[model samples]
Target: MDEGWDTVEVPARGSDFLQLAVADVPAGGKAEWLAGRLRQAIADGRLAVGSRLPPTRVLAAELRVSRGVVTEAYRRLAEDGQVAGRRRGGTVVVAVPFTTTPPPVPDGGSGEGGVPGTGGPGGRGAQGGNEAGGAGSVRDAGSMGAAGSADVAGGLGWPGDPGDLTGPSPRERVGGPGGPYVGQGAGGPGRPYAGRRVDRPAVPRAGQGTPRPPGPYPGQGAAEDGQPYAGEGGGPGGLFGGEPGVEVFDALRAAPAAVDFTPGRPDLTTFPRAAWLRAERTVLAELSAGQLGYGDPRGAPRLRRAVADWLARVRGVRVEPDAVLIVAGTAQALTLLHPVLRADGVDAVAVEEPGSLGARQHLRNGGLATPPVPVDEEGVRVDALRATGARAVLLTPAHQFPTGVVTSGERRRELLEWARDGGLILEDDYDAEHRYDRPPVPALRALLADRVCYLGSVSKLLAPALRIGWLVAPARYRAALVDAKRFNDLGNAVLPQLVLARLMESGELERHLRLVRGRHRRRRDAMIAALAGHLPGARVHGAAAGLHLTVTYASEVPDTEFAAAALAHGVKCQPLSWHRQSPGPPGLVLGYAATPPGVIAEGVALLGRALRELT
Candidate 1:
């Protein structure tokens, strides 16, 4: 009898979730009956290892039985080493017991009265005579209800009773007209035995019977076109053919070389990772929900204010926070400026002759013609710039690209006068913070604020991955630039802007600048020194400032051919002619900021050897 039978009632729900069940057991054997079911489930693969058996209370509720019934059943399985109760992680099936084999019978009936083998004709007579003399002994071993009868039956050819085997054993018995225990006739869902349990049918699931729609047959109906597709190379349905074009930096990025000395890269290893992480944590903790949402197209208010303060402190440019337009580096600034300039009847802008090829391409792509203006030791010559009859001239007055010359005071005054006469000046204050031998020069924007559109970025100061820069234009074009930014990705990402603002306000950016400037100065010196020793005839220009030095060779060798030969010798550099729209003497623009001093020496030495071989 099970304990607590009066205290609990069996649950009406069937087993589904955990596959637990209980039923009324036969008289005198309910505990053992339930234990055998669990053991059989474990022996076969139905109940996997580490599977958690339900708690006694839960299993009792699901099976409509007393909790003690489930507990006693689990205890019997535990006693057989088939299951173990784990605290909290629950009761788990552990191992199963193997069935034992019966002992072999002695030859020639040695354990019984002596008799001839049963295969002979007198065997039955001999067996009956021994049984008659030993009736009690035969009854003790051979009777079904006697002790040791199961051991003897195991040796005989009789299969064990299905009830004594496992639940649902290897066969099933279905009810016939006789009774619930009667076996059905012939073949059906049940097996050919009586008094055996049947397996529970698998429950039908909700979505299992639904069929999926078939896919389209192959080579049918124009290949199931989703949209009107177009082939490559500019058709009416092509991606770019239906709209205005966009440019990509594909060619320059694809070229391979041993040493790349292309300009516009900073020392990435000097990025202030610790300071950035600190800023990020602070921003995340303090930022408001509205701040993380789409920000003002102009920029975040904090970063704009910080940028305005920074420009006033470093570049000597005064501005309201509203005047600063945060952009995706200077590239976006140029793109935005392009339309405004074009609408102002500015068909052509004058560029320095040996200037940035990328900048020239950017302007040309925006439907503006680029007229070449000569750059001398004093930067872009205002006299020559005026001769081009162009209303706009782009100048790098702080540190000219390639040549690295500062625009002199006389030329600044001359250029300011030219701008005052209604000529627009695009001032690229690039690499102005980096100078070894001279004091800082005032930006051209400060001298003539109304006429100059100033551009600056952290690409040189920190890393290009930041992609954060700013532009301050005259009031005339401010609204147009903001609209362009609004349409282009709905302004820059807000989180990086917040982190950058924290860095700027905390004075960490200035500390990083001081460290890199010292390293770059040493590298620039190594290149200059190596050039002096190896190529005595080469005239080095722009050695006082910037990340690179320009060396002009007096020898009669083509600049492009010289660059190719240098690349063959495992050194990469750009020919000055690549940046020039007008003819000039042969030279190479070599960057040294990212390379170490030793590598700089080796690269310059290779260049010298390549020059010798080419000349």
Candidate 2:
């Protein structure tokens, strides 16, 4: 009583795996409350794409609750495609579905803010209030005649289906209760009437309609995952089922296990912690105030120079520092280029068969169709590429996805010729620096600088959490691409760039690379050995270099189903079928870089068992 009142701290009880403080979430309806909060955050753009969420274990520990509860909450989000599981990489916020209903306004007469009232046709008052059906009610509507007039035109006349307003289709209404409505015509008798169609309301030609909304899903609202709906003719609901894309990485990361052989991940344990910490400290100590503020959209000069030097030394890609654009990662680089290339009148891009599904999805999301260019033992078939009319192509020339085949010299020459003849190449030199085989193949960017847009990142070398990568484009497209980058995120963080520069320039990155290469080589060999020993019919490809290997099974089982069965056995690998646009033999892409030899062996053994079970 004598002293000033002291504040009483409430101990936090974790509900969600995030170990969210009770203060962060109120009591009562906790799950719904937490879900709504997360949804709101996503809609408001608080959590951007590729944002890693706290592990369920850690979050559960913080909230003082069972891990299952957190997982369940995350699963709900996953079902809605709001979050996804990426094995080894942890849960990442890939997307958030956007759904916002305008708030109601107080009124007998329509409010002046242009807000439409929720009251139905009869001006039905708020629920539990009187249904204003009297003749005077029309007067009430007429009193605010101006506002009501617009509402009449816009209101319940089936507010244009967000899907239909964007495009037109050939499927006629046939005959239904909701007569003559083009797309959402009433189906069976039990089907709820969507809206009454105005018989002669100026229907346009078959292709007529508003321009499809610009997003992953053209002509429809952007699903949470940033893809568009498939449209009326395509199927029911919108693309991604009128929801967001599922967070694949997050779900995989949440799965508990001792050994994980998931692909495309580097050894995080080998990160140069001491070097990074030192670099961070040094950068912070010397950082100018201006440097701490918004930075050059292209990149920090120091980091770009460091990256240019590093690329020259490692990947053999020579470039001026001015040409380098720092991005969130290669993921963003694809997004930036997708629109650029599309605007340049390029409609389609050919990709390697059994390539990275994610990469193909990214290009398709940008509105360009991806034609599959078959891959042989050498690399993508140049002859096939010539057959496809795609003016641009995305390639993992250094070490191809799933199948680690480097582009052979002849094929590379053919590709260069194709590009020289006005084709464009989006080179994803992923995992090029981590090779253990023969001398490195020169990056396609090096040989065809004018036609290639090169992408590289530390996600496979250091950690994806860094969210750092570089893009080097031809001079003709550099400025527009930089503007796109600027509009994308105003450039990546400066401090991280500086620290990365220190790591690269000081040779800390090279040292780390040397260390991980040996470990990964052992892991890769162990996996190959396990495959040879256990699954004799399996053939390995791209084993000489890269963190992952593609193992093709001569058996008849579909690769996607094989992957699902493998997941059931507590082993996860991508089915070869998932990456192919054209039909091919089934296989799996297994990553060994992050796992130890013992774990790699176990995972491969599990895979062999899964394969046997399938057969």
Best by TM-score: 2
Candidate 2: 10-residue stretch with minimal lDDT: 128-137
Error of 2 at 49 (Å): 39
Candidate 1: segments with Cα more than 4 A from true spot: 1-252
Cα deviation in Å at residue 272, candidate 2? 1.1
Model 2 lDDT tens row, 1-615: 111111111111222121133334445555665566555544533344554555676455445455776687778788889889888766667776765753231111111221111122231112101111110011111122111211112211111221111111122111212322111112322222112211212322342221222222111222344332122122112211221222333334555444566688887877888999999998899988877788899999999987776664445454668888899999999989877886788766777765776786666567666656666545677876776666888898767776665565556667767887888889998887665433335566655567888999999989999999999988878889999988888889888999999887665675576567667666666676777666765556556567877666556665655666677777766655455543345567788777766777678788788788977
Shift of residue 558 alpha carbon in model 2, Å: 1.8
TM-score of the candidate numbered 1? 0.59
TM-score of 2: 0.61
Q: lDDT of each prediction vs. the true structure?
A: 0.58, 0.58
Worst 10 residues of 1 by lDDT: 133-142
